[model samples]
Target chain A: MSAGMPFYVSPEQLMKDRADFARKGIARGRAVVVLQYDGGVAFVAENPSRALHKVSEIYDRIAFAAVGKYPEFENLRVAGVRYADLRGYSYDRSDVTARGLANAYAQTLGTVFTQESKPYEVELVVAEVGDTADGDQIYRLTYDGSVGDEHGYVAMGGGAEQIDAGLQQDWRPGMHLADALALAVRQLGADPAGGEPRTLTGDQLEVAVLDRNRPRRRFRRVQGELLTRLLSSEDPTADVPVPDEDDSPRASSTNPQTQRDSERDQDRDVDGGADA
Target chain B: MTAGPESGRLPSAYLVPGSSSFTEFLSAHAPALLPSRRPLPPQATLDAPHGTTIVTVTFRGGVVMAGDRRATMGNIIANRDMEKVFATDEYSLVGIAGTAGLAIELVRLFQVELEHYEKIEGTLMSLEGKANRLASMIRGNLGMAMQGLAVVPMFAGYDLIEDRGRIFSYDVTGGCYEEHDHHSVGSGSLFARGAMKKLYRRDQAAGDAVRVAVEALYDAADDDSATGGPDVGRRIWPTVGVVDAEGARFVTDDEVAGVVEAVIADRRDNPGGAR
Candidate 1:
């Protein structure tokens, strides 16, 4: 719309401008977690509502999630559900995989961020379970719509780095649902003595999983006393020493401190798939 | 093919904020996706499996609606214990009398449309808005209905604000008409309604309502071949649910078993099924 501007701009400049705008908006809100567990993934967010939910089934296998500005993300959620349903209706349900859905969201979010005046101030995660037990995959998409492939665990939100650091030593394979859920909660929970003063309940929190026992429908909200019971009952066997107080780094938009923060494990786990 | 999201070009309906009715949105965007868009071959009378009688009785807290499980296709009985009725939405249920496939599709789409509206707008549509939306959906399928496939579904749901249960009936043209007191629809509707007339009480409780429904369905099956009674051999019974102030909750298998057992006993003692 502006005159005197060249018809085309460099892809680098375009991408840079879009990313900056998206990062600013997203940094303003809390984050959500998409934990890839042994059987499937669980999306846990510290939302306080029995009726309103952050996690919902987009389809049989696919799910839609957001952490900031509910109205904006909710619209995306509905759209994602529509897209998924239509895709499944048109083609086979299996082909409507999580990766494909993430790509679609990336395309739409990236397009809006780059072309529209205001970018969506939300972050999303699209996860899929593979054939074998260990073939689960989680794709974390940032505000700028840039997609990141995550292994074992992926964290988002403002204080993501702190939690990621918290998970650095504790997260490991063969961790049961209880361990994974408790670890996730502790990572995101308010500190013993901290700045925020808000009490959360089992009903306030939302949890769901792509369970091995359950048939096609993997998305279910674990609510009220049930979730609270599960969270409190988890045995804290591998509680990592709180991120060494001295080494704790602030979370940035790009580096919301995923467990990969420690370079040692990054090479081993991130590339552990290369051998396979 | 329906005009799905893949087509970047949305119908004019997408741009404007129209009525809260999601069925209207579908009508404008892609009518083909709606159940009534399909064309059907004309016929004098369809001897297909006609779903059996539904009974809705208003009670103290709310209302309970139930139907017998039988679908008779001409001289030969077809699909004994077929569930002809279902809860269309959270607070509402639909019972079909015509083609099962089309009716099921209509019910499923109605569910999706409601969900879509709720997602787009944080709140659920009013009971009236929901009823109207279902009507429009029925209208969309008028094309197929004219040929021979007509679906008349009985809808019942609770109205939280009003603190009552509302049941609705529809014609082949998608005309929605609210039913008062007790109502029944299907081939055995006459017999079912007669039974409901005798059994129904204005302030019936949850249990009494279930018994009334069972009695009505029994009468329908006794007179009409299209209506099926509880099958002890197959362990199949009428799928029933209650619509009260809380919400529309289906009767569990165990609970249905209890009610059907009672109905079987009463029949054994008094074959007429009346006190």
Candidate 2:
């Protein structure tokens, strides 16, 4: 065998190999959640950096959230925003649609996957809010350019399977923003029981939404004290009985004092939440 | 697949990061898309009706802008009930004074420009930055201006940094200058400016400022045939907008009707208007 001569491989095997490589790379990143609720869609990512964001506003009614290589997804985010603005400028504001944006992204990703030596290790969700719940559209795009029209909720990145199962049990239509956000936080940080579940606080999570109630531009970031209030007021476990009596001493008394202490711990985690 | 211009796919210019200005991006990526990029014939003198008479005044809490409802072409009244004042953004107002069609188009594009900047940069442009952006847009229209379809606009905004209202006036060639107290533009600007010179004051109340703007437009309509005053029979009053630290808001017809009735009653008493 000559060292310079590449081994012959079937096209199917090559494509599968590239897809597996991209999937593995993406699985290493943290999870991101996109779900539908009353009045629009919400995105929650386990990210802490205020400067480098994984969830961003793409257009008036459209929002983009991605997980994978930071630089790669950030580049895609910029390009997506450019595409949206260009379309809105060329035609009309109402003409820019999430379907069109996802198609463009699919084309780009597909071309890169086939042409480049390595595939992009990224997953994207393009969501748009409409005049009514039936009109809301959510598109999930994978590294190999495959697209899925997810309904109700979509979860991706590390531990995505577990999060997806959890989301299936809790997600419902017409849930309030506070309830949906609390559920997302619980699903993202909850452990498999008999152990301490990971706690994701306000600053440790990047939260944004496409609020249909807003006029014109609908994308807005929810963070800081407001995020804290939303989490504490609608704690998903507030109504549930203690999970285990043996752990009551440690898990009990989520009183204002303990809540404040926990909030303080969360504040400390703000500086420690970087996952790059 | 070949990356041909006719392939109906996105041009690669979108994949790169350039200036945050949407106009600049359009110019670099698809030059044919920009409004300024369109070419006009050498002898193209637009015969379209032109809007006239806009008045703006600085008040104690904010700025007030008013425009009459009239369009004229070659001494003939082309249309009535034409609005020349527009809210460019949440805190800014733009009033067009010439070439009604092009001015409206420019205003709409300017609105998009501000929105695009905010979404891209994740922050609002400063009041001065917004004015400068408009100045450049007007400059781009210099070619059309030279062809006798000039567009002169008056811009007013609440300066959040300084916590006060400010106004900027432009010439046909895009020369921008800040106006103090009050300013006017359009064919009837001479008479309107004279009314403002007599009625405008420093730190007046918002209601008083509204009256002053309405009175100024009425005086302009009295002298210039192109400027139409409030038609009490049809209940058509001047369009008035107020820009404060809170934001820019257009005075509704109901509110303007009350102000117009008061102004007309006063004009009946003193047709010379505070002379």
- lDDT by residue (tens digit), candidate 2, A1-276: 598999899999999999999999999988999998786898999998998888999886899999999888877887788788777766666678999889888888887788889999999999999989888999999998889999999999988888999999999999877888888998889764436778899989999888776545677788776677777974443211112121111111111112112223534652212111
Chain A structural similarity (TM-score) per candidate? Answer: 0.74, 0.82
Q: What is the DockQ (computed on Cα atoms) for candidate 2?
A: 0.09
User: Residues A1-276, candidate 1, lDDT per residue (tens digit)?
Assistant: 588677797889877776776666665566567776666777877676756666777765667667767776766676666566555434445557777778777777766677677778788887776644577768888776789888877777667777677777688876777688877777777553466744445665677765543434455556555566666755343322222122111110001112112333424553212110
lDDT per residue for candidate 2 within B1-275, as digits (tens), equals 11234533345676676677878877787778666777899986868889999999999979999999888888788878776887777678889988987787687678767877776677779999989889988998899888988889999988988988899999877788999889999988999999899998899999999999999999999999889989989987898988887676677788899988887777686788665
User: Tens digit of lDDT per residue, candidate 1, span B35-137?
Assistant: 6665556664455655657788788877888877777667666777555555554566666777766776676667656655654554657888788878887
In model 1, the clashing pairs are A31-A157, B36-B141, B69-B81, B69-B82
